[model samples]
Target chain A: MLQQLSAQELPKVEQEMTDFITQYTTQEDLKKSMLYSIEAGGKRIRPLIVLATVQAFQKTLNAPVYQTAGALEMIHTYSLIHDDLPAMDDDDLRRGKPTNHKVFGEALAILAGDGLLTGAFQLISETTLEPTENVLLIQLLAKAAGIGGMVAGQAGDMAAEHQQVSLGELKAIHRGKTGALLTYAFVAGGILAQQPAYVLTLLEKLGGHIGLAFQIRDDLLDVVGTTEALGKQVGQDEKSAKSTYPALLSVAGAKDALEQELAQAQATIEQLTKAAGFQPQVFQELLALFTL
Target chain B: MLQQLSAQELPKVEQEMTDFITQYTTQEDLKKSMLYSIEAGGKRIRPLIVLATVQAFQKTLNAPVYQTAGALEMIHTYSLIHDDLPAMDDDDLRRGKPTNHKVFGEALAILAGDGLLTGAFQLISETTLEPTENVLLIQLLAKAAGIGGMVAGQAGDMAAEHQQVSLGELKAIHRGKTGALLTYAFVAGGILAQQPAYVLTLLEKLGGHIGLAFQIRDDLLDVVGTTEALGKQVGQDEKSAKSTYPALLSVAGAKDALEQELAQAQATIEQLTKAAGFQPQVFQELLALFTL
Candidate 1:
């Protein structure tokens, strides 16, 4: 199910992203650095999630949906670019390619990330959505990706490096660092679809659970997955003494947590589907993507 | 005239900025770093420009105007934070205080800048404006602050470091780096006031000339101003081999250029006042702030 959706939607998302990015025709090198990181492919999972959630709501996918999805991807990509900076994670490799700073120097890399981030806001704000909807979407995206969300998580994660942290601390870090934007992706779809308050609430819950499950899976993958499979270095968290779910909870425990979160996510989606009286098969299929 | 406006409006801008920034009630450390940079005051020039432009149109100041002003200041502060990173300008002092990275670690400083940039969008998008207006403001702000505007200029400026750049290249850099946002400030005020196209066009022109004049004056200040007076190290641009206007054009030539730009800016404002049929005494007063 995810494959079919990705095959259909990923190309469109890429096209929209490309079109939006190319609008800045000046600053060839800066544009190149931005395009390089963005064009470097990933699962495009966040955007797919957005499309799926909108589809689940029986809303016809439109420009606003695609642009919002593209914007989220841009934000995600920008964070990754900055995260890979020498002052941060200092990784030289991402997606089996040299990190942004490696290809373009640190200054350009930072600016490229800034460019993408600011561009994301531009894309969303300029979307054809109603003013109230645009406001809601921007508010959600900002809070999720801004200080209260991803940035805070990053700060905490960096601060906790080489230090022992409680399981609670690990959960908080994971929620903000990885969960906020992911959750926003799901909730933003709901916003675009004009989902009712109850439906939106359920979607947020579902997003939270999926976010935890996705992050735990990532921690597990880092521990057990090979560099070839992960497309980046493995065991990085351990090497840097950064706390991870698998580290805080043993591997078996982490797997259990992932299972629990996935189950919770499924339950919430079921509730949402029944309450909203819509088919959520696509959502279910998307959820399955998180499973081992 | 500048003093009277600052005395009345500067405090209000500061208060609004403080109120808006303190809304991030979580991640205490991250919030502190953000507030630290924000509270370490400059002249509040950008926000003041925004406010002054709005007043020039005789619009009763409202929440949206103050919020937009605050947002621009946040963007400016964020850019300074990022520009001062060791990878970029590498300055340790700003406004006679330790740069953000000096006080907060480089990681936190980067995150703080990100927070403020994101927060700026939140402040604007969440404003209680009509949807079309909000969209226009966001588009203008994003374009001015994004890749096509300030970020592009910064990239060009950085790329030109230690290299001999032509006069055309220098103007292009100044336009994006400095002119874009300044122009946006004027245009945004016109937007908020619902000024006609002719007025907005004039404001854009006014902003462009002022932005050029402001930058040239900065270059001159670097060449001649004292550290105690300027609140930053002088001659640092020369020390770093940055291609300033005075470097490419002789000091006298740079001053001549500044005068030309200022005169053009005054003419544009004069035309705007006549066309829009409003007293632009406040705007003329504001322009005086840029003079040596």
Candidate 2:
């Protein structure tokens, strides 16, 4: 069901994202580099998460929601570009294409990433949301994506490379690096829909569970999934000696953990829908998409 | 007079910047890396420009104004951190100390820069400005600091390395790279003070002139100033074979161009003050600080 929704909405998200990026498309090489990354297609999961969550509230998609979705994708793309830099992950390919630095050189790649990150804020600020809501959304994004959030997570991950990290330490790193932005998508949808405080809390809880589950699944895929399927190198954790869920927990144990998280997420959504006196069928479908 | 005002407000700007950054100060190495760059202070020129511009409009310093100033400084610091990365300029020294990448490694240095940039928007969004004004400020900062602004400028500069560039191209690069944010400082001050559109235009024109003059002076200093006095490597442009005003125009001609920019900036301030029916003494003092 969520796949169908994603398929329906993916074109719209891509169009909106292209439109937003075109605003900066001058004749410069910098603009070309920036557009190159955005045009490189992904599953568009982040924007879909945003749109699906908004739909779960029975709210029709609006400009603010679409703009937020586009901004989130830009942020995600920027992170990928920076992560693929020579000083970082050093990947030569991403999403079956030459990485940003491979196409635009290291300096321009870095600048393109910088431009996208800063441009995200500009997109949100220009949205037609109520001022108070706009501020809240911006605050949410900055906290999730900024210093104490994803950036810090990336820093921790880098520092822990080739080192033995405990499960607790690994969880902390994943929470910041992978979990923050995912959770922000749900929370942002709730904010846009004007969900009650209780619902917002439930959405955050659901996001946490789903985020952990998503990371665990990713770890499993890196170990088992093909580079063809994954669209990039696999078993990188083993190669780099980076810690992973399957490393800390056995494969079976990791699978067990993933199931537990999915269950928790489902329970939270159930409780939230019950309290709100409506079934969020779209959210339930989204959870299904996460299942193997 | 400008120096006196900067001295008086410098500590306050430092204090506010420290306070804003402190919010992300965890025991994590990421936080330490971020702070390392923030604490290795420069002359705090950007924030002072913001404060002085506000004073030009006869406005008292307030929380929003100060926060914006601090945020501007953070953005400036972030740019310095990235520019000094090994993948970029490969500088090991900044502000008379080891550069961020030197102390924290390339990965952490990149993350720290990302943190500062994203945190800057968070700082501004959390300010107490009216929603309209806050959005406008965010838009201005994003435009001046994002693509088609500083990032584009940096890209052009990097691409021009070891190559010939026309005077027009040089000015275009400096306009985006150096002039955008400097001009944004004045325009931001005007927005915060509720100045009219005409005054805002004058501020932007003033910013463009000063920004160009500032870059020319920087190039001149590279030719004449010692590394000890400059607090960084000297004669880098010549070493890297990057074009500069001093390269395109002779040293004497560069000095003449700088003088012309100063004169144009001064004239704009005079016209602005005369039209606005205010003395704009603070602006005059700021112009003096740039005159050398």
Candidate 3:
């Protein structure tokens, strides 16, 4: 179910994101630079999760949903662009392509990332959702993607570099870095679907588990997966002397942790089903993607 | 009157911006970096405009108005932070103080700016304004600060460096880079004061003129002002071979242009007073700030 929905809706997410850049940005270089990164490509998993969560609630997959999803992906893409800057992670490639800075130069790449980040809020603001909903969505997105969430997470991650961290501290870092927006995907889906606060709460928990699963899996993949499979250099995290789940938990223990998170996510989906009758099949399939 | 109001309300504006960072960011490093820029002194002209505009309408200077103003300042500050990066203007000083990157390191400086920008939207959403107002404000802000606005302008400005551009093209670049947010400050104030669309339209036009005046004055200042007065490098624009009003127009011609814009701004303010009974004193004093 998740596969079918993702395949069907992912293209629309890409289109919406591209259309946003083309329609709003008139400056030639700015437009081109923005489009370059937006088109550079990723799994669009954040948006896919949003679409799936909305679908699980049996809500109409409206334009607002897609715009919301696209906004999520833009924020994710912008983060990747900035993270790859020479000042930060300094990676030359992302998803096997030249990083944004590598192609656009550092100045324009920084602006492109800034543009995308601000553009995400614009996209959310332009959503066909009710005014109240738009307000909520903007608030949620800013917090999730900004200092309190992803930015802070990145800062923490960098601050902890070349230093061993407690497992709990590591989880906190990933929760802000990756988990915030991933959690937002589900919760925002619930918001758009008009699920009650309690249902949104349950969605938050589910998203949290999923977020943890995602980071652990990413850590595992970096340690054990190949550059070919990952589409970026492998073992870069360990090479940076950065802490990771696999390093802290060991490969086997990290795998156990991943399974636990997946299981918790599955159990939460069941609880959501009981509470709001949200379809669990899509969520279950989503859990499968995180599994090694 | 503008000075009095600015003096009285600017502290509150600073307080709100500071409160926002403190309340939202839990990560100490992120919070410190964000605050470093926010507290780094500037004229706070943008927020002061918002305050004066509300006051001009005989509207209560509400909390929402301050939040909106603070958001504008955040967007402006973020742009400054990013602009001062080694990859951009490579400036080491602003307001006679070390740049954010100089103190915080390049990576943290970048994240801090990102946090402030994203935090701006969060500040807007939390404002007590009507939900519809919040939506419109967010939409306007995202457009002004994002690709279509400041980012695009920055791109155009950088692209045009060492290359001469016509007056019209130069204006377009400055319009996005500085005009957008400066204009936003006025228009958003009108929105908060619940001015009619025509009044808001007039404010937009007024903002346009003020933006032009502001840029012209900046160009003029770079040519003739001292470092003590400017609080940064003087004559850097000419040093970079960047196009400026003084470069295209003679110094006398640039000053002439500045006077023309300030005159147009006064006319628009008068028109607003006629149409909406908004007081003209605040705006007239605002224009005085651009004078040599």
Candidate 4:
């Protein structure tokens, strides 16, 4: 269910992003810089989650939902661009492509990230979503992507570098760095579907569990996956002395944590199915994406 | 009148910013970094314009308006923080104090700017205004500050550095770099007052003229003002071969241009006064802010 829905909706999501960037960005150079990152392409997991959550509701998918998904992708992309900047990760490669700064130079790269982040909000505002929905979406996106979420998470991550951190602290970092925006995708989908408040809460918890599972998988991948498969360096956490679930819990223990999160997520899906009319199959399929 | 209103209302704007940041920012270090830039004061001209514009219509000044004003200042502050980055302007001092990057290091500084920019939208979202008003404000802000406006302007400015540019080209750069967000102040004001579409149009024009005037004055100050008064080095534009109003048009020419723009702004104010029941005295005083 998730596969078919993603194949169908992801292209629409990509089109909206492309069209939005082309129509709004005026300068050729800036346009190229922005399009470079947007097109650089990842699995587009955040947008996929958004589309999947919306699809699970069985609502007639529409432009506003696509725009929201695109906006989410933009935020995710901008974070990646900044994350790779010399001042931060200092990474020269993103998904085997030269990082944005490597191609556009640092100034344009920073501006590109700034443009994408700001444009995400613009994209949402331009959506034909009801004003109330638009406002709520913008507010939630800002909160998730802003200091309360990603920024704070990043700060904490940077601070924790070169030092050992406990499991609770590690969870706090992942919650903001990955969880906040990831959770936003589900909550945004629920809002678009106009689900009840309780369903939104359930979706939030489900997103949280999935976020932890996703991070643990990522940490596991870094340790066990080959560099080529990851499309970037593996074991970077060890090189940078960055803390991760596997680092703190050991690889076997980390696998247990991942299973625990997935189990909790499955239970949440059951609740969502009962309360919000969600189809469990789609969520189950989506959950498998987190598993090894 | 502008002075009295600014004196009375500017602190309220400051308080709103402080309160909002304190309430929302979760991490201690992140909060400190965010507040440092906000507290390193400048003229507060943008928020003053917002407040003054709203007051011109005799509308009740409410929390939404203050939130809107506070959001404007946050956007402005974030721009300054990013502008001073080593990747951008590379300034070490802002308002006679160490820049955010200088004090907090580059990674945290970048995140601070990101948080502030995103927080601006969240601040507006939390406002008590009608959802339609909130949506309009967000749309206008994202356009004025995003790739289409300030980001594009900064990109053009960087591209044009150390190169001769036509007056038309220089104006184009300023339109994005400074004019867009400045113009947003007036347009947002008109939106909040529930003015007619035509009134909003007139306010946009008024803002455009004022923006040009402000940029010219800044250029003139760069050429002539003391380091003590400006709180930073002067003549840095010429050192960088930055194409400014003075550089492109000669000092006297730039002064004439400033006067011309101010006259046009006054004319716009007259039209606004007639069309939207705006009081000209408030606008006239606001216009004076652009004069040297």
Candidate 5:
């Protein structure tokens, strides 16, 4: 089932993204760089969430929502590209391949990232999604990426680098940076389906909790997972003096928090699945991905 | 009359922009940095063009055009903030003040730039403009800023840095980077006023010619103007090995090209003025600003 879903659904998402990127890139080098960052191997978790949420709510994958999913992934990929720049995180590897800045040079990499970032907005504004929903998506995505969200999280991350941060401060940081995008993914999917505003708000809170849990798990993996397993450098957080759940909380304490967040997220979605033929299988599988 | 325009119109524009920036900033340091970049000053040429174009067509500033003028200035300011970054142009000075990166450090400068860019879109989408006009403005602004336009020009600028670029190549670069915004300014003004499509197209073309002429004149000024007059480091283009009109075409050749572009632009507005009661003096004064 995992293989089938990954092969079919994931490629559709990838192709949609490729098509969008092609619209903006003409230069062979720029196209190459954009592809390098975008096609670098990683599970398309964010896109999957979008597809799953839309699927869970209704049968049809609305065309505009599909574009939003692709655009969100582009924003995610752009962030990764910039994060690996020499001036930023300075990582030479991502998904076991040369990082964007490493492959494309710092200048092109910067432009590629900017291209992807603005391109997200371009995709959003150009979509034929219902105007009200379109407006809502733009507002939600802007807040996610702007102040009090992902970009702000990045600012805080950069500012707090090497500083002694409390557990609370670390959670706030993670919530802003990582959680912001995850929250946006869910809210955007919900908004596109014309889900109730209350339900959308609940999903945002749920996604935020899961996002925090997801990052903590990664931090734990970085501390313990082998380079081969993680597909990149391990213990990078330790090297950079960045605070993480593993660093701030005991391993068991971090695990407890993760489990608690998983329960909360599951609980929030439980009522929404009360209808006929509602399969909890996908929900269970998603929870397991982070829980494991 | 020029002093009155500067004293009255320019200050009002400055205050409006200052108010916009003040909302997103609370940190004294960040405020100082943002204000330094914003207030360090330019001719407010783009916003002025937006206002002048609207007045020429509608005889008064409608709500949509008024808000859009501010938004255009925001977009223009965002480009400057990003352009002056260490990784981009590496300029430490702009408009007689420290560039954003110089004052805020590179990371905050990047965030500031992102904030400004995203904020421009937010301002436009949420405007009290007519819904149809709001939609058109969003579309126009996005196209101007995205892949084929302003940012594309920046990409070309980066690509051509340190290379032997021809006059045609330089014109293409400036057209995308500089001309795109100027074109958008005039077109946006025209759209907000519900001007006919033919008039809008003419304004776009006219704006492009002026944009190219503006760039050529900038090259001329860089070589001859005082730092006090230019309000930034002059002759830095030579230091950076950038190809300018004068560098590629000789001062005399560049001068001839500027005159030709000016004539073409004047011809466009002349037709517009003949068909409608559009004020030609607005653009006439602007032509004098650059030419005289």
Candidate 6:
């Protein structure tokens, strides 16, 4: 089911993101780096989750919200660009190609990342979302992306280099680095739909749980999967002494945690599914992406 | 006058920026990088320009625009961080200290730069300004920082690297890269005051011309100023084979161009100052910053 939906729906998500990225970035070098990082090709999962989550909430996607979803993908792309920089992960390889810095050189890569990151806000602010809602969404995105969220996570990740870390510490890092933005995505969708604050809070928690599980699954896969299968250098986490769930937990234990977290995430959405005006298929589809 | 004003006002600008930066970043490594770049320090000229521009416009010095002004300095700081990366100019020193990547390592440095850039948006979005004005301020800020402004100019600079560039091409790059944001500062004050579009437009033009002269002066200083005076490594541009106005035009020629541009910029503001609601002294004070 996951494969089937990704095959059908993921392509549309990629197209939408490509269209959005191309709009603000037209410089050849910038386009080269943006396409290099963005088109290097992943599952386009974040944006799909956004689209699916919005659909599940029974709101038709409007232009402003659609643009916000695209901006989320750009933010995701920018993170990848920096994560793969030589000063950071320093991996020459990403998604089976030379990393952004490798292809574009370091200065352009840094600027490309900077451009992508700043460009995301330009995309969001320019969206025609209602002023108050737009302001709220901007705040949510800023909080998720700034020191309180992604930056904090990155700081923690950097600090963990060559240092021992507990499972809880690792979870905290992933939760900020990866989960904060994901949580913001769902909360953004909920806010856009004018859902009640209670619903938005639940979605934020659910998204957070899923984002944590996603990172753990990624960690586990890195230990077991080939570099080609994972789309980048695998097992580098151990090389870099970077902490991961599988590094802290036994593989069996990590898998068990993922299962528990996944169940909780599903339960949150299940309640919504049974509620009036919910779209169960979207939630079901999102869960299926990870279960496989 | 310059030294006295700079001494009194510069520390406040530096302290405000430091406070804003500290709130978002505390990872020791990230802080090391952020501090390495920010603490390396300049005259706090950009933020001072912002505040002085506001003061010139008759706004109280303690107005909320001060926060917005500080945010602009963060953007400036981030640009320097990226520009000094191994990929771009590859400088190890900025303002006489190790560059961000040099002191903190590349990864943390990269993230620190990212943190500052993203934090700027977060800062502005969370400001206590009203939504209507906030949206407009963000639009102006983003344009200045993003593709049509700073980023675009950076791209032009990169493209022209090691190549022969015309005086016109150089001016365009400087205008976009440096001038846009500086212009945004002047226009931003007018914006916050709800100044008419015509007034804002005049300030914008004034900023553009002054910006060109500022860059020209900078290029001239590269040829003449000591490292002690500039607080950065001297002659780095010539080493990089990057073209500058002084390199493209003789020192005397560049100086001549600066005088012409400065005069034209002052003339435009002088015209605006004569209007009933417009204040000539405000613009005269702003222009006087460059004259000495």
Residue B129 lDDT in model 3?
82
Candidates ranked by DockQ? 3, 4, 1, 2, 6, 5
- Chain A TM-score values for every predicted structure, listed in order: 0.97, 0.95, 0.97, 0.97, 0.93, 0.90
lDDT, candidate 4, at B68: 95
Question: Which regions of candidate 1 deviate over 4 angstroms?
Answer: A275-277, B275-277
The true-structure Cα RMSD of candidate 6 reads 2.7
**In candidate 3, how many Å is residue B98 off?**
0.6
Local error of candidate 2 at A290, Å?
A: 1.8
Candidate 3 lDDT score at position B67: 88
Question: Candidate 5, which segments miss by more than 4 Å at Cα?
Answer: A1-5, A26-28, A274-281, B1-35, B59-66, B274-277
Question: Measured by TM-score, how close is model 3 to the native structure?
Answer: 0.98
Over B54-97, each residue of candidate 2 has an lDDT whose tens digit, in order, gives 77767788888888998888899999999998778888888779
Pairs that clash in candidate 5? none
**TM-score, cand. 1 vs. native:** 0.96
DockQ of each: 0.74, 0.67, 0.90, 0.85, 0.45, 0.59
Model 2 chain B: lowest-lDDT 10 consecutive positions = B273-282
TM-score of each: 0.96, 0.95, 0.98, 0.98, 0.92, 0.92
- Higher-scoring candidate on DockQ, 4 or 5: 4
Off by over 4 Å in 2: A224-233, A275-279, B25-27, B224-233, B275-277
lDDT of 1 by residue, A61-93 (tens): 888899999999999999999999999988898
lDDT of 6 by residue, B1-292 (tens): 3354466665666676678777766455666667667777775666766665665556665535767777788888888888877777778877767788777777776787788888778777877778767777777787788765788788878989879988878887888789988988878877766677787888788888888878888888888789897666678778888789888888888888888988998789776775445556645655666652
Worst 10 residues of 3 chain B by lDDT: B269-278
Q: What's the C-alpha lDDT at position A70 in model 2?
A: 85
Cα RMSDs, all models: 1.7, 2.0, 1.2, 1.3, 2.7, 2.7
Error of 6 at B120 (Å): 0.1
